[model samples]
Target: MSPPLRIALADDQALVRAGLKALLESFGDLVVAIEAADGAELIAALKATPVDVVLSDIRMAGLAGPEAVRCLRRDGDGTPVILLTTFDDSTLLLEAVEAGAQGFLLKDAAPEDLHDAIVAVARGESLLQPVATDPVRARYAYRDQDAPKANFNEREIAILRLLAGGYSNKEIARSIFLAEGTVKNYVSDILDKLGTRDRTRAVLKAITLRVI
Candidate 1:
């Protein structure tokens, strides 16, 4: 038989952690390897024991969930993370995903949804709650798909995706085999086409428009 998936739980609230632990344990395929009160504790625990997945709260006392994911990613830890949040903030969702979280779930999600999310995320799938889905769809609903596509070609889309990951122009150039100046020009064109003045805004807009 396959070994149970090890999971780490990180939430500021003791009661919430207890409840989540209980619910997760109810699924025989999952095992809680570590429990932490906040993202800081989670980060520390991660250094000790490798887990199959991390379920973390978005807003914690220190080192919020997204930041923890970012830190882990920076440290070359590719463990899947599922961020939990009380509020369905679109900006937060985007930030969490951009930070390398595999899933974003609301605190009040159904037990089955949580279980399925954990399973899916641990297997390299992504999950975003409906609260984020509606807004994203509504925002893109008015786009004219039949109209001529924006001038962004394949290479520009590749560069924009790297930019969204917070890579520098030099790094992006290295990634796509282009000169730094060429990458800079592409970035400028991307910003102009997306109607954003800066790289951060360009990424956010691209995410909003599902361009990257």
Candidate 2:
């Protein structure tokens, strides 16, 4: 049998950490190998133990979750990290994605949803909680209504939609039967046309401007 996926849990509240650890252990396919009260402790735990993924609370007292993910990315650590937050704030969610989090989930997510997020992130798939989707859509609704439409070809539009749906470049290429390098070029064009610096902003700008 394949070994269980090792997860590191980080949260400032002791009870919250205990509860999350218990819940992850209950999944049978998951094992909590490290626990930390804040992002610094999380980094230390990572240095001490090899883990498959990290699950961190977004608003801890020290080195917030997004910052930790950024630090990991800056250091060339590609381990997938998932961010948990209490509020369904789209801005924070986007920041987490930009900071290299593979998943964004609310603290009150269902046990099954949390488990599924862990699994998805481990597989290099991206996910955002369903409850958080509408608010983001709503937040961009006014912008969508007011913004001038930018020109996008059919393929670019399809790719933009997939990007907004959290599909990685490899996944997008697979879905559309395009070469990965070609997809990268297309993504660059999309970003240039949207006047955004990165994929997250490109997707948000596309949505806000109704370009996709």
| TM of each candidate vs. truth | 0.65, 0.70
**Compared with the true structure, what per-residue lDDT tens digits does model 1 show for residues 1-84?**
999999999998899899889989988989999999877789899999999999999999878899899899999999989998
* Candidate no. 2 TM-score: 0.70
Per-residue lDDT, model 2, residue 121, is 78
Question: In terms of TM-score, which candidate is strongest?
Answer: 2
Q: State in Å the error of residue 80, model 1.
A: 0.3
lDDT of model number 2: 0.82
The weakest ten consecutive residues by lDDT in model 2 span: 141-150
Show the colliding residue pairs in model 2.
none
The number of the candidate with the highest lDDT is 2
